[model samples]
Target chain A: MNNVLVFPMIVPILAAMLLLFFRSNTAVQRWGSVGAMTVVFGTSVWILQQVMLHGILRLDFGEWLPPFGITFVADSFAMLLVTVSSLVTVLCLVYAAFAKDEKRESFFMYPFALLLAAGVNGSFLTGDLFNLFVCFEVMLLASYVLMTLGGEKKQLTEGIKYILINILSSWLFLLGIAYLYGTLGTLNMAHLSVRIAEAGQPPLLTTISMLFLVVFSLKAGLVLYFWLPGSYSTLPAAISALFAALLTKVGVYALFRTFTLLFYHEPSLTHKVIGYMAAATMIGGSIGALAHRDVRKIASYNVVIAIGFILVGLASFNIEAIQGSIYYLIHDILIKGLLFLLVGTIIHLTGKTRFDQESGLIANYPLFGWLFFIMILSLGGIPPFSGFAGKLFIGEGAIGAGHYGLTAIAFLSSLFVLYSLLRVFLIMFWGESSILSKNQIPLSKGMLAPLVALGIITTGLGLGMDYLSPYVSEAAHVLMNPDVYIEGALHNE
Target chain B: METIIILLVGVLVSTATYLLLSKNLIRVVLGTAILSHAIHLLLMTMGGLKMGSVPILGDQVDTYTDALPQALILTAIVISFAVTAFFLVLVYRTYQSTGSDNLYELKGPQDE
Candidate 1:
């Protein structure tokens, strides 16, 4: 039990607290951020190992019995998410080293980044509903700071909108928790699931479930995801990418956790609702992406599309569908992180993010151009890429569940994503080298290293799906069978 | 008694939502504040309100209130306060930069 599972949550908070004391030294801040993120990565690997060995690790706080106090539980699913989030954070921090200006550096960017890490970890690990709300707040607070760090005119304006929407969501989350607490008389997720199952489909249960969906949908950038494109595009590229990659995934993760565990009985109503919403989100996001010329906005819309796919998986509620969603989530995080990093690098180099303002990057920076090509293609779900593998799995899951129509929609949405990405690639990289000069600013090795690393990781994920399949399948099993979770929560006396 | 509190909470929520949809940024912030207060009250009321004395350890404490929801509300109230304070500062900065409190005016080049 004295393993890496605990460190991912601990190291970040510790690092943030330590950072509060060192206000005078920028070098200390920089190194502290790097060191903290590295520790988190190492711990994530250790926790992954422990999950691989012990199946799942449940840690009750202070040895207190569950269904009373807060609990931090780690199954294969949560560990997988933590691993992905930590890996993405490390890469984003590396990129931020080169990309962020002095103004951004001043706002405790490193500490806030670590705080975001802690929040994601906590959200993934916590066994209590109210604890999840607190984690969401932690994440939102850090995100507000990160979004407004540079004090850019656009950042502040859009940051206000982002802040307002999220705060409202948090309030709704609290209200929902209150309602759930009133109905179930418990906040522990595992225990709540049992009570919910025994109680069957009550009106109060449905109301709370709908509330949960609304709050998480706002976070996940579902059909009502206009705020994302506007606000996400206003931040620094690294920040935007990180937010685009991980934050919404937290919402999706919550949906998966709740629907599969606590609200599993009303599949016809709840799952179907999610499925329809997912369909709308996919079509809406793809249309929005096609309308945008800015790389960041396009990426943000793509995130919405990915969220749609995840919702479909969860909505399906079948083993294959859930497993596919899980696999796609991991794939989306890595590939999307790489795409954002590449786009950030491009903007950093060319001093512009719009396709019309800049053109012909491939002729000058062949390495970056090719890497961006791979990332974009992988994002478009091309074969032999991680994105393709994820889509294939989700498609297979949909079809296996006899949802052939949903499978078709998923395939069509993939094509839409492909079209949008190809538009950017053609306009930005594959033209005559006359519209814009080669970028004069030298790319930092620290920034380039993570992008290269992510590129390899994305391909490796595609190549190594066989090794990951068993773990993902096991996660699906754990999710489908609530008995173990209920027993663990209730019998931990 | 429950109906009265629910109606009052409902009014507060509607007022807050209306204010949030207004043009002024400050009004929006105020709306959020009001809405959070309403949510806290709703949480308190949802745990099934009781006609009782303060939840304290004392003699003749026959009718004690639901301490759980109250505790949860207190925590939420503090968090909402912190977030409100943060939002105010951010709005101040935003107003200073834009030289106006109207959100519509703050729309950037992309909006045009």
Candidate 2:
């Protein structure tokens, strides 16, 4: 039985439920979540191994057959994403335990985090579009709780905007699903692909595709990425790390799926729109990054810029482009997670996030300065770090696609990211050292472990890229070809 | 019947859009609610507004309705209801912290 496919989602839901029972016990909740994520991470890695060796795997729920009942499909792409997501969740849980966001933790941060993981894993793995919507709701609901858990005046204002906008986007997503179902008579993604191909990409198809583009773009923080920095900066660090790494990436994953799997017939139209938005998001993101003085806010804009880079690769629509995007995506997530952790450390030491009054951080904590230097190099696409491979691939691929101007923007934006990060570095680490804040919380080994571990993984991805390259190539090949996903998901009983 | 529903959806969407343009927090929540309702109804109408028998697999069920859209609508409704409830709570919380529901005030510290 392929029932193993659902374990990635099930384990987390079960973990969250277990966590609810020990709501007041932070130790139990923390250990329980870490244990749960470890299991989920193991399952995801195993599922990924099986998927790679055996090709796409499918699990039909209620045995209602493929098109009629719910289905969970673990293709190479979905499994890969789930693996990273689980890894990120586990790391974030560890970071959060040491993070001391006590008020939020008391209000069940662990349970909500588990639920968020479950929702994300479900969305990535499920083969049904409607089920994807439900999973999004589950994910967003958990996010609502997590984002507003502290209930500060700052949190409430920003959280309200986050919720309202996402709610509107959710409704748009629903409308798109309705249109697709109305047109195709099925909600299964594999079935939709088949029907869309049969229908020869109608005008209605274009309309529906546009709606989906908007929905996923909003989630991915692409064209409308303005909401991202403000909201993220206002959150606690661990949650921001999780958000930066996973949440919008979910949108990007959904974008990759819908664009490649269903809406590929008119790539000239659809992919071009994607390309334009990628460009806009690129220019917009760098400008936004330069607009901020706070370290977290600046890095938050880097999140937007990285999304643009990945989207450009997707829009290029070549094997190399997809490969680069996939590779860079994993790279970007680890790097951003590390960046947030480092920023969190800075905030912990200085008791202020704004760079105006903070200076000479490295004089106090020299280790973090060097670590941030490595992260900045990695993020700036310097060689022998994780970001280099993807940027190279995408650059070459964009050149191949005759997107010369966009390629220039890509390089230009990377420089801006480099400059902005270095600006923060110069102000915080190199300037006059002030006495440590009176309320400074000492950093813990457990917390430092995740940051160091993430830093190593990110570096290893670059130095050991030969190992990751083949997998990214394979994943890109599988994703670009919809037949494999369709055949696997709709496999006969 | 179908035309009326389509027109009604149009009206609902227009009204939602209009309400959404305002800066009031409550209006924004109302806009989202109405918009979700419109989408749900649009889904129903698109699935086909047919007068038919119960959707059962009987020999007598030749003219039965499509159950899939109904199931889809139920899911959408539940999600939107959750969203709406969350929106109200958020609005209430926002109101409690700042004595006004105007989004302009929450725009920044400068506004306060």
Candidate 3:
């Protein structure tokens, strides 16, 4: 059992608790949390390396044996996500550090952010279903506090809706777990896999899997995204960026894990349902993105659209599509973080939220304009950017799967993504000057540094696919072949 | 015994659903709490009822009750308690800030 898998989770949690003692000291909280996250990032990278060298690594708590003990499995898929998420958290913490929002800082933002990261890491690593539930709650509770920290009227109203909806979803999740445990008599994912295969996955199991789908859909914002755009539109940029980057991705990860590993026998039922839900989400999200004049709402809808696109890869359920999903998942995390940060920065600098409220920003912030232009291209799945390869592979997979209609919708959605962002770009950044000279808030270098860093990372990700392809392929192979994960997790090849 | 608990769970769930459908904020919070209670009971009943002795080792016995569901319910209970408390506080603050507890009144964007 490798000990390294735990550090990615432990470091941030320990740092969060330590940050609590220094809550009043913003300096300590800021740099300490960043330092802690960087360490987590390093540990995650190390975990990836170890997984590559030793195949899949599993850690059973208290030395308990399989199907009886809680396990933390670090496959290539989980570690790749952990590494990227840690990197995103580090950058978000840096952004939070320099944003200079003293009110937000004073409310223990650093601790909650770290706690959220820890919860995210835990969710990725867990091999037990119950532990996954617990991790989701940990992440949700931390997010609830972060979402409503300021107690503003808008934050509270939206936050209340967010919390209630999530509570209901979590309850559904528990009920699903209860039924699964009752039927299969196991919570360990690997053992559950073996048992389901043994039982030939009866109709009752398929119905239970549907419960998980609905529960995860609410969290992932797939089709049940009614609450997403509202709550996301109200948060501060850094917090919102973190949420946009990390939260839904966790739900998506859970979907990928369960569908690929546990519920593969009923693909015609489960995957077809996912395909339809994803198509509907893309249509609904595209309409919302196209209709909104509010910049944040547009960006939030863009998030929904991306979720649909990624799940399309899952719906195809081919190796190529899964690989594309992995590549795109990593790309989306970094790009969404950058996208929200830029959108937030635009709103912050202009003190306006609507596309028409401000103009001629490029004249003042040319660098910001270029970065945003790159963001638009990257998000639009333009060639030679991070979003391109994944979209291409997913499209190819859809075609290969004989899903011509889905392939068309997937590409069409990219066009919508481009159109929506271009609308924001043309009206908000390129038009005649709207802000008075005295009113223009000079873009700070500290704030711009994180955006530039993410921009470079996303660019590097696109250009550096040669290096990432092996890991991505390995991850896809494992996901496409659950026997690999089951054997790895249970040590019973 | 299992059938009885399942029936009880169904009753609790219906009562909680009714509470949740109302417009008041406090009722919604209470609904969530009762709903969680119903789930906990369902989880417990899922493990089978009175088929065996206590989970701990004792005199020779052919079987013992599954303790895992009990542990899971305990965790769920603590989490629900925390979430209910947090929801109450949030509702109070929303009321204080917006001067309304009615869901319909709080539906639209109040500050924006």
Candidate 4:
């Protein structure tokens, strides 16, 4: 019942409300969002420390008690994501201040973005199924607003497909929940887990699990993510940076959370599906990126690549593998955020997102080119960068779990992704100067500050693994063992 | 009676799915709306169709209908309503701008 668990979520909501009130005042909204997100980052770090010091921090709304009352449970894994995504939100907001279209800014995009952050945090922390749906709705609603704020024809068209696909997926999600509740008679996640264990795995459970898989996979942009490349590519770079960093990962997080918590009974059936999907998403995402000539589209496709990689960790369902996945998830969030912001800046300056159409601004803006290079390398899982750690752990762990074929697929697909990302980087930055070679928008200090801060932190994360690994390993340990979560969630210890 | 409701739900979902798979944007919206109705019915059915006294504690009621599903369906109804509204607006905007309601004719970022 620690009050702190509620603040991380409440802070952004309050910020979003205040931001909505000040929609006309861009300066107030901008500073207000930064201040609010900074509070979020602070409190999430505080919660992470509290979770490390204490065990699980549970906030039961309305004092109704667990298995009845809605709960916000903060294990290390939840706290860690909140911490990273909060930092990312703060950075993206800074980027949004500069790069977001002035029209979009005046239209209350910032508030919806904050609301989206709130939804994401709620989804990460909730301890039940129904609440998860509600949180997804909140996130998606905000995302719908943010994506179409500009009223651009492209945004509307792609937004149509995105909304349709998600709505269908959400209906399926509700249908799954209905079935689970009817059979088990509980919507509480911990209670459901307890019930499933007592009753053993039922045949209906498999069907429900598949339904959940489809819903989460669509969000995660896994192999089923046909809507993602188009929808994400059409977005303004600032908003898409935030989307790329946080949105799909929410899906990956749900998949990890639920499959680990509830569907462990039929790992042979469930894990195999996850494993194969992971491999396919990884390979398909890479190939999709290779096929996309657009820089933003390529980055959007790489999101699928990371989704696939993280799934590989979860699919293996071993300590080391899950640990690696957690690390990779963090690395991907940071790396992807960096890519979107950096590329957004490029697009912001050049007004061209297609790789074939742009180049040689790197000749003048060496800083952007260099930072983009770091992110590109990190994204590809190159050695000693942030991405390598997760790959190493997942790869070795997959091998340890005797998933040799998946491990090979994981390694091989990454090579293709690496080649594609590098090709885009070279063509956009190294080759002939784009038409904008003569004149470039000066990089604002506000923009430069967040990028440099993020760059240093990425480097720090890569170099300071010794300090970070223990915390990551601890979070993975919590994920590996679900009984601890169930007890902490249900019993209120 | 239970079998009839389940069969009806099946029919609704199948019709909805067929509509959704069509290339017309309006049909997809229709499909989603119908699909939601089917799901709401399924939710109510899942909670059991037994008619009973209201769920009032200490009323000495012999059997009480489940209240949770009703509450959940209320929320689901509101959400679906909002979603449908948003979809319609989005559809209108897509039409006004893209000048087409055929899903394929809207815009294809998939290829070029």
| Best candidate according to DockQ | 3
lDDT of 4 by residue, A1-493 (tens): 3878877778888988888888778999888998898999999988888888888888888888989888999999998998999899999998888664679889888888889999999999999899999989999999988888898878888888889888988998899999998899999988998998888878788878988998899889889988998888888767898999999989999999889889889999999999999999988887888887788888888888889889998889999999899999999888888887887777777787777787776787888788888887787788678888899999989999899999998988888778887887788888777556446677788787788878878888888888788779878887878898987899955
List runs of model 3 lying over 4 Å from the truth. A436-439, B110-112
Candidate 2 segments whose C-alpha is farther than 4 A from its true place: A436-441
**CA lDDT, candidate 1, residue A403:** 75
Pitting candidate 2 against candidate 3, the one with the higher TM-score is 3
Clashing residue pairs in candidate 4 are: none
Q: What are the per-residue Cα lDDT tens digits for candidate 2 across A386-406?
A: 999999999988888878888
CAPRI level of candidate 4? medium
Task: Rank by TM-score, highest first.
Answer: 3, 2, 4, 1
For model 2, what is the alpha-carbon lDDT of residue A421?
Answer: 94
Candidate 4, residue A220: the lDDT equals 90
Model 4 regions more than 4 Å off: A431-438, B109-111
Query: Model 3 compared with the native: what TM-score?
Result: 0.98
**What TM-score goes with each of the models?**
0.95, 0.97, 0.98, 0.97
Instruction: Enumerate the chain B TM-scores of all models.
Output: 0.86, 0.91, 0.93, 0.91
Kindly report the docking quality category of candidate 2. medium
Residue pairs that clash (backbone atoms under 3 angstroms), model 3: none
